[model samples]
Target: MKNYHTHTKRCYHAIDNEEEYVKAAIQSGYTELGFSDHTPWHYDSSFHSTMRMEEDKLDGYVNTLLKLREKYKNQISIKIGLECEYFPKYMDWLKQMLHDYPIDYIILGNHYDDTDETGIYFGRPLTKQQLTKYVDNCIKAIETGLYSYVAHPDLAYYDTDDEFYLQQMRRLCETAKKHHMPLEFNLLGYKTHRQYPNETFFRLAKTVGNKIIIGTDAHESDALLDMKTYHLAKQYIERLGLELTEEIHFLR
Candidate 1:
């Protein structure tokens, strides 16, 4: 099995070093494990982010992972990547970052609207307008071709079963299908009983024919050692008859 949404302590919110997560993935029998720690963006403002690594630490993050990739080459494939938000103002900087670093891939986290510098968190149960805005931002992000897949595709946490919610999600799923972007079945949310990995969204994804990819979204090292959630998530996806993709397009 392969999982791309892994994290490291450099992000400040996760636990352990990159190697510990790598060992855990090997222990869990994952053929490939990607370290997509929350990435630091070059903010035009002095907006210090406590959730991701610092922009200055970007090189260190890449270099360390490169070494680990070589060290664990025979055990499991290690991909060096980042989980990034699509802050439009910093897109050029992010593009430059992609060019400067040997980043293998990036996944769209969409943690905040606009930029986390001054935006609402997407996890909260959103207003109809906020949810629609979230969908719009996701469509824009998908169109960029920078992100490999949409992690936590159903992140906007809109709780009721209403036509407006369905309409927004339908458009989101359709756009993803058109772009060939697989929406992630976030294992973190499922295992934690979070609002995401929402059944309604996946049902819409299934109907819209969007491909699904399972993401561990591992914040802790041992999160990878346990494969029960992965197995259960697999069974859940299989039972839904939604197509699950094991491979993704690397950024090269």
Candidate 2:
């Protein structure tokens, strides 16, 4: 499968060079690959580290990927993009950046709530109310008509229990269906051995019947080498009876 949310070492939490990732993609039998390293937010935020690629490096990142795209045009289709964390608090500037950059695609990674407040991936623990707001912001981000696909839609439940987070997941799946937006099913969750969105969310999505977009959420070159989790997730998806598609749309 094509990994649409691949990352590079340039992103502080990730570790791997672009070339190494390209080589891995070829070896993994992928036909298409998307390099969507985390885009540094314009403002300081608690969800991510400040050590990510600087503004000046954006061009180099683009140029390097363009060169690779050329080199692997025949072997694999490569697309360079960014996984943007949406913040309605900074909508004006956020919209400006989206227009300014020649980004081929955008992945909505809702790393924070509407108030620019809290998150589960970071040190901040969110309340049930906060979780609701975070999911709302993610849905709003998709409604804005900017992103190609929503990355980790179930991530909002990172801090909550399955029983408490179930309704929220249902609402999230409902929103995805309303907007015709796809929720990324990340395999890294299984690799890291986290409860992840929990099978509860996946089962709910199945009952509600929302579109599933498969993504490895690979932060490094060997990220996809974890074949066990991929197969397990595939089995889960098959059990749920949801169709996974490859037609990357929205911005195209």
Q: What is the TM-score of each candidate against the true structure?
A: 0.98, 0.88
Estimate, for each residue in 1-252, the C-alpha lDDT of model 1 and write its tens digit.
899999989989989999899889998888999989999988879889999999888889999999999999999999988999989888998999999899999999988999998999999989989998899999999999999999998889786488888999998899989989999999899999998898888888999999999999999988897688888999999899899997789889
Which pairs clash in the backbone of model 2? none
Model 2 local distance difference test score: 0.75
Task: Give the TM-score comparing model 1 with the true structure, all chains together.
Answer: 0.98
Question: Residue by residue across 16-122, what tens digits does model 2's lDDT show?
Answer: 88888999989888898898888766555545355457666777888889899999899998987788877776777767766776667888877755433443442
Global lDDT scores for all candidate models: 0.91, 0.75
Model 1 alpha-carbon drift over 4 Å, by segment: none
Q: Alpha-carbon error at 109 in model 2, in Å?
A: 1.4
